[model samples]
Target: MKKVVLTTSLLAIAAAAQAQSSVTLYGRIDNGIQYENGSPQGHKIAAESGDWGCSWFGMQGSEDIGGGTAVIFQLEGQLNTQNGTSSGALFGRHATVGLTNENYGTFKLGNLGAGELQQDSWALDPQLMQRYAISTLTHGRNWPGIANGFEYTSPKWFGLTLKGQYDLSNNTNWNSGVLPAGQGRSDAIEAIYATGPLEVRVIYDELRSTQGNFNNLYAASRSIMGGGTYTLGPVKLWAGYQHLNAPQASDASVFGTDAVSAANLPGGVSAPTSADHEWGGAAWQVTPAATITGAVYHTNVNHGNGNATMYTLAATYNLSKRTFLYTEAAYLHNSSTSNIDLGNDSWGPNNYNGANNTTSGAGANNPDYGHSMTGVFAGIMTAF
Candidate 1:
């Protein structure tokens, strides 16, 4: 009996030690019903969800290493609640590992969302309606692919924090056939400030891609964005501005050339030309469980020959902590010389193509397009 008691005690201690090396499993499940019109010249209604927050499962853990330092890691992936399929490439959202010290800062590595994403994430609009989530609009712009990278986040100082990230291209060439030397390299930098009821951020990103064609046409794109938010009583006001410039081949070597040519191909015979976008919104909490949000976004594209403007509005409502309903409507008023299009050939409909006049559809060949998109979504979300 003595020996058995001693063995049981040892096992207990081992279990406790293991528990100290904490690991947690967490996830959110969201789904709803949706209706869309003016999409590819059709009207449709279907079961939809993931507007407020994508359904996902994640595992995170931290191990104390003594000396006031710890090792941490997280792995997360998105899911499609309707079809029960993976959202995208495995581990598409986040896969990172790093270390933290009580007095120092934290450093992480892998494919992770940018600091700009955090700025957008804090918006109170999504709490009321998923349609008001800025993430739904920015999509690719928010999480530019960095391949392999590292990020550092400083400990908060007087309610202010600093973060920086660097991504290496592994020296891979994306323009072997398009451009003689190619420019398939990229980099990014960002800064942020937060205090009390105010928050602000600025970010700059550049990407160089080589065209796989004769004349070795190389494309280099750059974007700069700055924004801020202020809170007063039950009202929160937000504003932001972004500038994007992409110059492509004089001819049809790049993918965006079709739209460029269709628009009369301005900007001195280059691709993409230039685009400036400005947006702002306000969120009002009408009650504890319900909020009202409204935002307006405008984009001006200059391709030398012509220009165009696009505007959007979105709102949402939270029925409960784990459930919400939302709606979004957008209008693009193109000038006579402006050629605007829409489709979901890439990430999704949110990308918006000007030349085709097609919007992002739910699935491939879903035929949802043209002029405007009005969608109403109602869904429930549970977190664990």
Candidate 2:
């Protein structure tokens, strides 16, 4: 009898300890077919992934460690559902370990996302940063991942919370340059305020290139964004503005020595120093499971780089709690000197920078300068 009682006590203790820890695996898969016109190579049709949203799998867990604090960890990776390939590394999306407390807040270390810059901007973006939304105009500068990062998120006080992140280049030269592991040293800070039906956020972030310079207007630059959303019944309104600057990108050298040519450069200038981007839109929940959204995004690039505007409409219908069908249509108009395309970070065949004078059908992903482009997409997404 004594032996049995002792064994039972040990089993109960083990069970109690196990109850203090928990883990969860979650992910989303999105795949779709896309059709577009106006690339230098002409119209094309293809299957794509992560157009409406990124397809990724991840596991997050936490352990209660007494004193109103807990240890938390997350490992996430993005994959192209169409090709079964990962984005960069095995866990490139996120790999973090942290401690959280209700009173003190959360502190994390390791490879991480752009914190609230990415989190809050999604909510504020009219198109949720989709394939042809905000990221498209700025060449995907708005969404960046960080490695060797340290992050801190403060607890909500009233309706306001604060967060910040710093990524170390992990080199001896402080901000020497982009390393094989990640970009040069970077930092960002954000503030968020949420009330009954409205939320607002502001962020300031910057990334550096070789010799700690902002060499690429879209790749290595500084950006400040402010935006907000208001909820009214079944309709939500979104508006935001962002400014990007890369002072070091003053000449054709940033693009490359062979990048400059008569096709792209009219006066031998092939670099953009600054840009202003703005967008606004609204979403309406027509029914319990359907939503319709419309938005406009515009960008004005300086240095004769011209400007572009995009108008888009999208809809989503939920088939179940974890699955949905989505469709969207968009049109992008580029100025006489600009070659912005319809897809995110799409710079076209000239991908070199400046405008391309090529009218030939080639291996280009976007249209020629001064041309217009249109696109349509349909896809299905599921989360688990």
Candidate 3:
């Protein structure tokens, strides 16, 4: 009888412990067919993954330790669902451990998500920062993952909250120049306010080059972003503006410009020293499970690099709470000296077969300089 009573007591204790700890496995997969025209290689159709969103899986867990505190951790990675391929590195998306308290707020360290700028901008992007939206013109600058990162979040007070994030170089020389290409220290600060049907956010961030300078406007630079949203019943509106500057690249760099023909000076193209980007759009919930959005994005490059504009329309129909079908159509117009691609930035010379031209390295989808581009995509996405 004593043994039987002891066994029952042990089971009770185990059940109580289980109730205090929880874990969840979650993921999403997206795939689609895409069509585009305007590249020098001609029009083409292709199967694509991560066009509308990324395909990734993750596990998150938390244990309540009492006193309004908890220990938490997350592990996440990305994969190409179309071909069953991994996106390199296990847990490339996130590998983080943190702590949270009701009064002290939350803290995390490790490979966190993108910096505060990207996180804060998501709330104001009408297209949800899809492949063919805000990121297209900026060359995916807003979508990079953070490594060796530390982050902190403040508790909401009077509908206002704040966040800060820092990404370390992990090198002996702090923010060291000459470490390697694309290796630099970065940091950002963000503020957000939400009340009733209105929300707004502002973020400031900067990335240093391998030379410890803002040498590449599109790659290593400083940025200021301000945006917000307003919701009225079934409709929501979004608008934002961003300023980017790279004073160190007043001359030319590898990502700068080169002669497109013998008539022009060789290796004499000047890179953009500053730029202004703006976007605005609205989303309408036409039905309980259907949404449609339209938005315009524009970029003005300094130093006569010219400007470009993109117009896009997207629609989604939900078959279930966890599954949806989506489609988008877009058109991009580039000025005589500008060459911006649709969907994703090529991040290289815009001209075709120009001096030291390396558009092939980026992809064959880059259009010729002073040209236009059009694209359409249809895809299905599901979350589990």
TM-score of each: 0.77, 0.94, 0.92
- Superposition error at 86 for model 3 (Å): 1.2
Tens digit per residue, CA lDDT, model 3, 1-384: 999999999999999889988999999999999999987777889898888888999999999999999999999889899899888668877889999987888999988754335655767789987878987888766665557788899999999998888888777767844312324887888899999999999988887777678887776788889999999999999999999888986545533444343223133446677889999999999999999999999999877677899999999999999999999999999887666677565244443212122334344565666779999999999999
Per residue, candidate 1 scores C-alpha lDDT tens digits across 83-153 of 98987656766788999986798988876632323334344232322443333333234434444667887
Please give the TM-score that candidate 3 achieves against the real structure: 0.92
What is the overall TM-score of model 1 with all chains considered together? 0.77
Quick one: best TM-score, which candidate? 2
Q: What is the lDDT of residue 151 in candidate 2?
A: 90
**Model 1 C-alpha lDDT versus the unseen true structure:** 0.55
How many angstroms is residue 260 displaced in model 2 relative to the true structure, after the best TM-score fit? 4.1
From the highest TM-score down, the ranking of the candidates is: 2, 3, 1
How many clashing pairs does model 2 include?
1
RMSD of 2: 2.2
163: Cα error in model 3, Å: 0.6
**Candidates ranked by lDDT:** 2, 3, 1
